[model samples]
Target chain A: MKKSGSAGEPRPLSLEEIAKTKGSTESETWELRLYVAGQTPRSVTAFANLKKICEEHLAGRYNIEVVDLVKHPQLAAGDQILAIPTLVRKLPQPLRKIVGDLRDTERALVGLQLRPTGTEVRE
Target chain B: MCLPNLGAESRMTKAVKNKSQEKRSLPKSLTGIQGLDEITGGGFPRGRPTLVCGSAGAGKTLLAMEFLVRGAMDYGEPGVFMAFEETAPELTQNARSLGFDLDELVKEKKIAIDFVRIERSEIDETGDYDLEGLFIRLGAAIDVIGAQRVVLDTIENLFAGLQNQGILRAELRRLFRWLKDRGVTAVITAERGEGALTRHGLEEYVSDCVILLDHRVTDQVSTRRLRVVKYRGTAHGTNEYPFLIDEDGFSVLPVTSLGLQHEVSEERISSGIPRLDTMLGGEGFYRGTTILISGTAGTGKTSMSAHFVDAACRRGERCLYFSFEESQGQLIRNMRSIGLNLDQWVKKNLLQFHSSRATFYGLEMHLAIIHKIVQEFQPKIVVLDPIGSLIQAGNKRDAHTMLIRLIDFLKQRQVTAFLTNLTSGGDALEKTDVDISSIVDSWLFVRDIELGGERNRALYVLKSRGTAHSNQLREFLLTPHGVDLLDVYVGPEGVLTGSSRLSQEEREKAADLIRQQEAERKDRELGRKREALEARISALRKEFEVEQAEAQAADGEEKKRERALAESRTAMARSRKADAADTRKVLKKR
Candidate 1:
């Protein structure tokens, strides 16, 4: 039912990784790097928030590599990062991105068109 | 798709990119309409639940039924109808008049109609459980009949029954996964929210595809519409569409409705009227062609159709005649005078006439009856005597769709169809009765002409799909012998018009009177000259007669004088005087 492009080389990497990874990988795995500014209260909160959420939501299926923008400004431009806190869900389908501290799960769910309720996630 | 740093500038770009992405993977489906499937690239994704949310009475149920019935009947895919509202008996009865024998379909095991009665008080969700119970039933039925379609009448019922949004939304999410995993195309109906796609805001929940049906009253004219709100992963039509629900069930008409999908025949077949056929081309209307005859009232449209049926009957091809204006007996008897005896055809089982009053019923009923006959008779040629009468059954657009379905249905069977419409005006209106001209392969326009001081009936081939036709308007006359296309009435007046013919007759009478006066004058002059010459000759004869009489008297006197002179001369020499008198008398006689 998911009519993935009948034409076109099945793009194995995200657009950024495709540009950076070049020949280093052949696994066809989506590697995502969520960039943040400094380990300020906002950046710490965003990292802790994304770690637990990814484990509970995506469940060990994805890898969320957090990058600190204050440490490496060059990496900010590499991923085209402008905000301090951003969560990028790069995956098997359309790679989606959400910026800011992941406080509102409703917004994140809508952005991804993900079913909001897990068997235990419902309040 | 490019994204700048998440600045305000990038934020604006993200919105644009979001719209563009939404446009890319649009979810499209057949809607099962003729030109529409091509537009949507072959229907919605199967088994992926499509949300059909609309305002009140927007034809959501009608559309869902149409899709399911079309699949079951046309596509041979049995369907399952799960209605949270409306009982099985009610749905059957509601659609029964539309010729949808849901009851019969259920009996045939071709379709399963289930009423999911949800009682809120009964919901003792003391234990954590998904609505997998309902899903299991639907799945079982689909597996039982190999049903390909699943319709949930109103999705709002779920929210209405379950007060806990957390539990309800969770089950809603699970339902999509369950249906998609099962791989059966599903259409779930929902009531529209005040402004959002659905009242429960479920547009984002189960929307692998989304279709919105709307009923709008613009300028006091209500138009029911259907729109593919959003369908992911398919290229779909984005325009709001108008649909109709009549007896034939729900029929959706695509925005750009006309396209040549089937191969049209270049070969023309006989319309049974030799005159009309010859004018159309050497042959006649093709066996499976749709012919439209349109004109004003009393223009022999019915008679022409009757002639065609009579001809078909003679040739041993069955014909179905549907008359919206007159009774069957009236049609038969009226046509009898014009040499079309339907009674004979009836006996032969070659002609069937169905006559009904359009105003006596509804549009859906008319379509149902038409569809029913098309299914039953299986005639070689079908004639809708005057489609104009059926326009009264519904608004103009409904009539168009019904006629389209009818035409498509007939053409599939290769049955030639003839429809007549009484166009509104005499001024050569730029528009037709209902754009019936679009669906028909051939258009026959019969018009009344005013020329030569006489009213004449003329028939012409406005358009014949693929043949060399005579564009000349032939004099069409209805008589006891049948309809005839008279030869060209060539004259200085050119083709004789109604008033021109009458005027020519009037002018000819005046010319005859003038010629008569000129001939009488010539005869009188010849007689007068002859009489004058005879009178002059008579006068001259009288003069000659008088002269002759005097000459005779002088001769008599001279002879007497000569005798006396002879007697005197004999007596003596004194006869010299008598000799001189005699000589004088001789000179007078000479």
Candidate 2:
């Protein structure tokens, strides 16, 4: 889903969406930020897994931003990140966090609230 | 994996090299916490991680925070606090009560706090992940302040936040090594586990130093104790020391640090009562000596302590009076009745009263408070009114040990300590519940001598070390003026006191008067007998004088009769001639 902007340039679009949403209008844009530490294997896998999930479920309404904490460690304090490869749902009310490589798709879906909890999402 | 192993190898070599270079002892980082440095033989090992493990509410976080705050404020060492349990704002607020302005310190760029919020419910683990984010945050915080000290308070929260224990444990080991590689002295706090030093056995990784803090409640009183379990490459105090957390922050009382090598002062101080002073070697208690005044209730223990404090204050010496039984107002008012204006001394700041219930805190807390106040006030004299009250706060052995430490502390400072003990009525007067009698320099026993339907107080110096003291018991009196020690009546009936002594003195006075009257009567009778004998001898001499006069008159008459007969016979001229010759011869002889 590349509706808002490219994944590499999601900050400005998300800021604009947040400012607009402060008014009475609610936006349908899904803003997701993934926190990682450098180019580790888990970070790469989590990014790949997240991209696949977003393209499959929220095809045209999602934006993915990758925050490498090694380069910008101060950004970790914003989302209270302790584990690497933490996926934070920045927008879409009730912020959620999913940690790890996101290798298990069903669990990731349940964590991000894309699928209801306790539902067995078989392939 | 290869890179991490190489890093570990390099760190191991560096540690070895460091050990070789400093073969004597590990370089230390001064915690600046009072009494902690002394117990640690300096402080925590430098550039190494020290695990401070304790149960919940045992002051682990405060201790670690103080380490950082003191490091920044006092030692000029910038520190970074990576808190896993408390937020930065919470820590700052909590430290504010201890007089540490953490926010100000942070504004000065001397301290940096990073809270690693780990909520297990919010995060779902899908696959393998390392705590690289936490490492990055901590490193960034450390680099921002160029910190020489770091604190990871309760870093074990990662276990709950992450699913893989293998990764978390490995990462923690690496983190400790990394902290060492960064050459920053670090304090890591952990929760105590069952039969283990920490809940996660974090002590296994950070092995340079491990301190165990315990908060134990005995008899409904809680005491906080700290013990240095292991300090590698250096000797440390092995005893469980009592620590206090108050407005001044954390202070560990290194009780046994004082040895018996205190300099003894030969100077003597008054016991307040002049007679009592005279009883104690004609001077008073030796300066720097511990004096125990043990007595039953109402035997004037507090009154005696008040007199001591009064005397010390009158001498212009600062006196610290710790009254465990009475409040400050009550003590002052009561001393006023004894004609001692303690309020004046208090107003002049020469006397300070620290009154509290004996059960208000554990014995250790009381000891710590005593230590703190003694250090701050620097009093020349310390008075613990009825120290036996403290025995109720702790076991007899604990109270004994605390008293020994206290006595040693006071003796080292050459502070004359006056300790009053309340002996129960049934127990022997010579026995003290705390069993601190042996170490005391002087022991004064006051007891209630019940006799002749009256209860009276008597005092005697049981023992006075290095000074000759009175062995006789004196009747203790709490008069309107002050304490008075009167000589108890020691007669055929044993030691008598109070009104009985007064009555006995009166009875002895009457007996003395009767004895004087009997002697006067006997002297009068002997004078009369001498006068009668003199009269009888004079009468006898008068009778002998009358008899001599009668004999002389009879001889004269006989001579006249003889002359008349001779004249009648007159014719005989021969008789006349013979008489004339005889008369002439007799006249010549006369």
Candidate 3:
């Protein structure tokens, strides 16, 4: 997993690394970052739901970076996280973000652009 | 509240912001505010941030909201209102009162209201931060609505919520540039500072237009005034103009509109009275000119004004009468006594009256209201019964300036204006409260000429620019038909009027009668002498004729006797025959 240590500090990733994760002559890998204040109930549910969706749909090709803002509060500025428990899709580029507890799975998937609308979720 | 250094970051972002800002070329976005559009010469600079600063309850929020709402509704440019101090529902409810259906606009995606709620107690500054979250939210809202106008109402609330002043300033500057880069015209409302324009001195950052709104109370009358402090790359009115927040929203009145470049006309309109017309060079006042009728108390000033209006209405021209001293009914009734039937004109809708107390508002507000009504009514002539009452509403200087502007405005529209002023407490005709004689193109003074224990109304043209007017004081008369002017009787004792003229006339008549009687007596004596001379001459002629006839008879008798003696002597001598022949001739002639 690739991580930014705190806000305003971006660790640049090599082009080849991004290319490989975004499926250059290989299976597509998803790079996701989840921001949270602490391991609260809502935050836990968001993380669990996100993991379940990824396991059922993108198992063995996904990486999750969990940023606990309580421990590293300065990291909030980097992603412009006004609210807690925000999920960011870093790979398959054109980075997208969604802010909520991720309770509504279908809406979250559609907002995150993981699946097209009116389609079955892959198992 | 220590602030982190954001110099380098701001510089870098500013470069990018300007690069994007250069790509767009839209110049200005119309605010759609009445008179404000004229003042700004269109509106705020487009795709740039404009600063609107004012004190609390000074209509800052209302101005900003109107900009957005009017832009969206009138100009078809969708807008987003980012309210920092008020909630979304509160804003929606507030806007509803202004006839702006914010909820419907939001539902149609024509407008988006984002309540940027920042609780001071909840937010803590841990380290360096940028307002990227706000930018993202704003960008998202704009993208959703495709807004062309944006308003950040009372952005100073961020100064309290955010603890970092340095970063906040940098971010704000960046945000403004960012809005410009996004190509959306933005209005940022800020709280007025003690001395500076904005609390945070946002004017330094906002380089396009800066408007200042002020609400001041003087003599228990609160007036809202607006002034454009700075407008880059454009000319705007710099004077303080009075504004109002009414049901339709905030309307800023650019009182004078700054210049005196109005068009002039040479067409003339009648002065209502034929004699008065004759006094005015037989052409009356210019079409787009201003006239001043100044007089003392009970000098028939109102009557003259009514005559002017009645004549205008008779000519099928619309007229407006703004009465400050009397109500509409009272004025109509008063005019009726002088044979001016104004009710018929009112019924025909060619004449309208707007009566109000001069103390109803401040002078600027009064000017604004007048301007607004004039625009709506579009009358050919406007009459202010006593413009002096307006002087009581404000200072002399302001009233004078207001008068000049009013005259300039009317002249620009080519509407002839007649303003009546009461010359207070003075014998001469120069006791005007506001010296507006210089602005008026024509001035007619009506005065009371008291002579022989009777006051008489006299009218004269004081000055008529661009025309030669009669320099005579005519005896002004108000007959049942209308106002009339009689030639002032100028006998040996100077100008006479009223009872003095009548008495002078009576004295002249008596003198004329005495002169006539003396001339008739002398004519009779001369006729008697002519008769006596004729009688004597006739008697002398008769006596001479009788004497001549007697002399001829006596000569005839002598000749006859001589002829008899000659006849007797003829017996003795033949020589007597010749004498006897002469005697015979004389006797034959007798």
Candidate 4:
């Protein structure tokens, strides 16, 4: 899949490549925008789950940008957010949006085309 | 640094005067209604695009115009109305009927109303163009009139006329930003979508606030409800509040104030139909209260409403009767048989009849007419006979908006109203009866029962807001004398179903018991009569036996005569057989 963000702006990196990119990273490269509206329960859950996922999955390689419409409504223009609780792959080519809470790991993994957690070494 | 202390106190005093009529603890807003700024906390988010999306005929344009006109009148702020669809003359005329006097306002340099005419087929776009022309004209108008409020009578047309999808989208984004920057409260009327709240998708992720207007009918009762779907950085009433549009202007009825807090009366007045009043409890509903009488077809819905109007006139209260089902004369003639004399009320101007067919037009057009009449007449009570008839014209929801507005208009004036609705089945005791029960405070159900080979008209109070109404269903009769409320008939088997089956069962059971008792008495009496007859038969038998014995004893002389005759014959036979004695006997016999 073609990603839109800076680290993978030209092409989506495979799990093995992502692991190598993490090894060769100079600074936090990925810029992600979790677009949400207010402190509604679903939005809050999505925000919390996204932060945890970024911390666990990308470690210090990604910079998570939380764009709350409650604070800055104008930021909804970045990735053309429509419904609330949208997770946008901003730094990846062919920007993708996954709506609803990010707690559904299987759907998120498929949407972002992330490699299975323990199978990265096999690739 | 601001330093204005001189006229501020007097301004506060004027504001206090305006505050008396407002609902308690309302946020600082104008609420976009005429004479309503004193009620809302403040005008709706100033300079931000407020989306007014509801089902059709929901008083959206009227509300927007009210905001503009009220801004010009109450606050002396100039207003500009830019309609993308209607002509300036038509828009002005529409406002005029509501006492806006747009032409006069234009002369006073207080309002600039323009209808931006755009031909969709003739327009072509080659490159991205800034809508600076519209902005420049709007800016010039604002400068000329110092306009504070602006309304775009539906932004959907702008998208319709311009073919440059990319530019239009960008321009719309720019347009909303410009309105915000200009700091003038902008109302953008958007057509509702078949699926979405707004068709153009602009209402998605609104900038500031979104108020949805819904017009709907439940069980034939139409109601228009205004609901604040989204309001950023503010708290608003989430429920859909009822509203009205008329010659004066559109007014949103704050349904939450239907408590002891508002002015009300405890005095009961007849519903013009005595039967209806008793259903409301004892005499009837209190004056200045809304009454809804609903029932299925042929249940006397119109007659009951006519009867109510007749009673109101007799009580010296002016009433306006709005019949959407039948003509005035037709209504009068039909109700005459039920004893409701509306001619006298019409003569005294106590009752004014307004009848029009429901298919005349859409719900908005009907609401507009209703608003005009209520504004002109200002009657003490208003009546909408068979509100459901309008549903045949459009969706149930559209009919509802017109209803809410009508009810709201009367309630705001403190004029009591009697609305009639025709239900599906003529069942008065339904589990959830009367569709408009939510909008109305009181509900009366009228029905007819086939009782004992005769039909009985009955009425009962389903619900009455803020009143101690009886749950008892009272018997009612309509005759040439007028509407009479009959006393409650408590029969042995409880409140009888309006059917002949109950009486038939009683009759059948009584007949059966009577026949059983008569049969048993006949059985006992016949048994005694048979014993006497048996004894008489035994005596006759004994008498017959004694007669037989006497006959036997008396048979001796008759037997001896017979034997002598036989001996003579035998002697003759012997003579015929050729003996000398026999020959003589044969000659004697010959």
Candidate 5:
């Protein structure tokens, strides 16, 4: 839950807004905020894995925002991030949070409520 | 349904396995709640979840908060309080009133408060949701502070926030297991269900211990009680114990532990009044004994209490007087009239007066307040003037139970306590509700003896354990000097008291004077008769002497005549012989 949002105050850029600013199309854009504390190995691995999953499934519509909580710790409460390596989906109708490194691609995808391209037939 | 995540499942299995290993006997974590440790044998089971279910306003939240606060402050165990119903600030404010400085504790990192703001309208529960967010938050908070204790206050508030019950229940069970796996003692408060211990049957999951708090009202008096429903692998007290939530926090009086195992003292103390002390055997009451002074109104019960307090104070021992009927000033003034100057004792800091209306709180609260005050003041003697006022606040059974517990507590501490109870109506000496005569070691009954058309106070030692007390009744007199008990005079008209004794003494004095006066008059008359008889005898003797003298004179005169006659004969003879011997006669005449 986003507890507070100061209207006139400067805030960190979301991945979708950054993507739109980068001249990406506005149709069905995926926005995600990956919270990390410093440049730890687990955080690095989580970011790499999240990028790989987005590049493979959503090449043109995906965006990822890396928020280093060590530098901006106050932003953790805004996204309700408790764990060190957490990925919050901000653009989706229903916000979803996944804790820990995204080592298991299937579980991370399922936790973030993102379906693979051919998952319909698999189900 | 095939579960996609094995990580959480494996963690749950590991927790369950560890808990089963501890099923033989659970270790304890002392709750630091008064009298609760005695009942639970220690406290709640450690490193496991204890469910606290109670109705609204039943003090469930306060109990949980106290558990956390006491653990952090007293035991050096850091705690995390996860409030699902109240915000952090609100909780801090509420706890501040109870003297739990949550803000300072939070700042010191001894305890962490995380308010879980989950509004129902703001959340959308899609398919396949879990409480992993909550787990992460709790785990992070615990790890940050290295908390050994965790309190989830009012977990039922989640039901209002979350949409799905099945998922919530399953996730909650997993959460409790996780908390146990984390090896932190957890207390989960829940709203009481209609027919179950908790609304969602949460007791089945958090089954190590379950405590139920109830605030019930009877006859317009509300009493808060706590009961331990179950404590797995440990023996616990099953009776319902009354608890109080006040500024000092929660205190539960273990009703079942009030056994007669307290140590007795051979040391004797005076009952304040020397006469009263003589009535109670030769010495007085036992030093640590509970004394019950029962009487009707205006029978000098409070006055008797004041005397005991005064005696304790005079001994340089600290005393506490709990006046439920009179204010402190009024009590000091009233006692001054009876010659007990408690004000000086107060000034010397040897005596304290706690005056409050009896109806100010319930019986349990009153007991808790007394316990707190006694602990703080550490008085050597305690006087609860007219404990009967407590009976007016609640049921008779509750008052009786409270008295028994209070007396037990005092005796356990080796404190001399004097409780005065006003016996209502009649003179049968019937045991009233506030009558603790059975439990006390000494029972002094002050009665108003209505004789001689006036009411006179009388005191008698009805029962004094371990001492041979006097059986005679004494007329209790409350004079300006002090309390003095006069031996009741046994007369032909039964016990003489008041003006009748005075009148009877006066009558006896008058009768004695009359008898003494008549005897003196008779003695005087006898003396006058004896003096007159002696004078008459003396006069008779004088008269006899005079008569004897007259007789003697007559005899002398006769003798003289005889001599003269003899002389004449001799002269005649001499004359006759003179012729012959005129010269010889003249020589003889010469």
Candidate 6:
């Protein structure tokens, strides 16, 4: 895991690194950033659910960066963040956003494009 | 979280302390918009959110932006504009057309702008969340500028950006509470919904004040109106005021705000024509009174107005003439034909002419523009020539209301208004289309009196309040020298005018000449009769003298014979003394 120690600091993977990794497998390195207002229970749960999903889908090809807007409020304007506990997928061709806590793992995987949306596996 | 909670509690305490001092009336933050403060009884509620809801292109965003700009510039209150739709540069460019320099204000740090763009395609829903990030950003903006005013332009975009309705609703309520706790006045704009005040029912949240703007097109004429749906803790004007959005920004026209409280003036002014003045109680229309001159087409309505304007300008007083049917140059040239030089007054800045087509704008816009110009010019006399054209530009009811408001405004300033109306030939000459005759202080009716194969213009004072005006009809003559009012010829055949009057006058002159000749002949005949009587007397005298002579001669002859006899007898009587003495005594007696 690549970590950004400071709160509200966004560390995006270089495009060259992503492009170089794209030839080896059909899937590339997944770059995710979790935005939160403060250290809330919902954000902690969303971060844990994200980690589990990334490990099960592609073990060593994902990067997660946590951003706390309460520390640097001006950063919210860059991502147009209104709701807390928001997760942004930045490395993909098209950027995506997921708002709320990751309490529903299957729905969270579908939202992050880790699993197919139509298929549902019963617990 | 604990520190923010403590700060909110302290702010709440400070607000509570201010409430005591403001117990008598609700403290209001002035919006500085023209005519809006009057209708709102000052402005929006202080430290509270006001909901401004309208449909698309209804000027909601512009109104909110104006509120902020005016607050910062006029009221010395810094504002923060949180825009959900437009960026700062886009907003600045749009406001620049209305004479607002938003960029300068932002540079001066008098205003803070934050654009929140939410794209639904890019946003996804995972689980539970709140809008705390928005709160932090807003708080930071407010703190940076020390803003006293806040504007959330179309805050309903949050409903589209987020998926959780329950959390969004709860968080919106908390946000409003937080804004209030921060002790700043706020304006929130929302889109109008079908059968609801706002699309997201935001009115349920911001209950202090609600203003609705509407743009409607009727008969191909669009008018923008603003109505304060509800204003708590104060009495506000309930009428829907017509507002204008032009290069000068928003201006609301409160029609019925000015009641019948204008001070009346007993001083009368001249009507330009001496005969017309004589018809109007030997003085003229009352100062600061409305005069309506109603007539059919080509009845000298414009000529009469021109005469009035000339008279006012001749008095060295300012005059403003609004001509809806004729251009300024055309009116000037036409008035010149009647011996009235209006261009000189225009050059001298004593007379101003505002000429435009009646259909160029809606009735409300016309009224608003008139108000603006009147305020700027501040003329003593105002003349609206042929108000009939303006009346036809709008519906009858709207035209009447606008006139009432206009008259009230002019009267309040002690400005005399001279309005001309063109009535249709088929309708009664006494009736006007707008039906404003009853409210006018004086009414002049001009009509075409067809007589002896000719049509003549006749004018009479139909009504003059507080003046004993003449009831006689005078023939209106548009002479090259000027307007002339002649005493109509009243004869056994009724009122005579034009060629028939001239003919009647000529016949009377001929009859007078014949009567004078007859009197002279009678005098001559009397003189001849007297001379003949005198001559006859003299001749008679001569004839009597001749007769006397003849008689005397005859008598003399007899006397001679008798004397001879007497002489002979006297000689005989000499012998006889008695006869001689008697003859001598007779001679002595002779």
Number of the top-ranking candidate, with DockQ as the measure: 6
Which rank order by lDDT, best down to worst?
2, 6, 5, 3, 1, 4
Model 6, B144-207: lDDT tens per residue?
8999999998888888877677888788888888888998899988889989988877554555
Off by over 4 Å in 2: A1-34, A40-64, A89-94, A109-123, B1-23, B560-571, B574-590
What does candidate 2's lDDT look like per residue over B291-379, in tens digits?
Answer: 99998889998898889888888889999999888889999998899898999999999999998988999999999999999999999
Give the winner by DockQ: 1 or 5: 5
Clashes of each: 26, 0, 0, 36, 0, 3
Stretches > 4 Å off in candidate 6: A1-31, A54-65, A116-123, B1-23, B545-567, B576-590
Candidate 6, DockQ score (0 to 1)? 0.45
Q: Give the Å error, residue B17, model 5.
A: 29
Number of the top candidate by TM-score?
Answer: 6
Candidate 1 local lDDT, residue B86: 82
Candidate 4 residue-wise lDDT, A23-94, digit = tens:
544353666777666667777787787777677667777877777665664444334343456676655433
Instruction: Encode model 4's per-residue lDDT on B1-590: one tens digit a residue.
Output: 00132134324434544553466632333655732332233557666777777666877888888888878877787788888778668988888888878888888988887666444322222212345445655655666688878887877777776655666677778778888788877888888888878886765455477778888774454656676777665444444455666556776644332222236677777776644554555577766777787766676767777767777788788888878878888878887787667888898888898888877655655665666677778788888877877776566755664565556556667778888877676444442222556767788877776666677777778888766777777666566786565654565755554344446467868999999999999999999999989999999998888888788766876678766765676766666655666555754785
lDDT by residue (B1-590, candidate 5, tens digit) is 11122233334334433554464656789999887876676788899999998999999889999999999999999999998888888999999989999999999999999887554433333333445556767777888899999999877877887666887788788888898899999999998888987888765456688999999986677889999899887766677778888788989876435555568788999988888778777898899888888888899888888888888988999999999999999999999997778999999999999998888888887887898889899998999988888887887777876887788788888899898887878645757555456667788888888876899988888888989899988988889998888977787768887787778878879999999999999999999999999999999999999999999999999989967865775687677765546544654674
TM-score, every prediction: 0.52, 0.86, 0.76, 0.49, 0.76, 0.88
Where model 3 places Cα greater than 4 Å from the true spot, the runs are A1-123, B1-26, B96-99, B121-130, B219-221, B258-260, B562-590
Chain A TM-score, each candidate: 0.61, 0.74, 0.73, 0.67, 0.73, 0.72
- Candidate 3 is scored at a TM of 0.76
**Alpha-carbon runs more than 4 Å astray in model 5:** A1-123, B1-25, B528-590
Q: What is the interface RMSD of each candidate, in Å?
A: 22.0, 5.0, 13.6, 16.4, 8.2, 4.4
Each model's fraction of native contacts: 0.00, 0.83, 0.02, 0.00, 0.02, 0.81
True contacts kept of 5: 0.02
Each candidate: RMSD to true structure? 19.0, 8.4, 14.6, 26.6, 11.2, 8.4
Question: How much TM-score does chain B earn in each model?
Answer: 0.60, 0.91, 0.87, 0.55, 0.84, 0.90
Total clashing pairs in model 1? 26
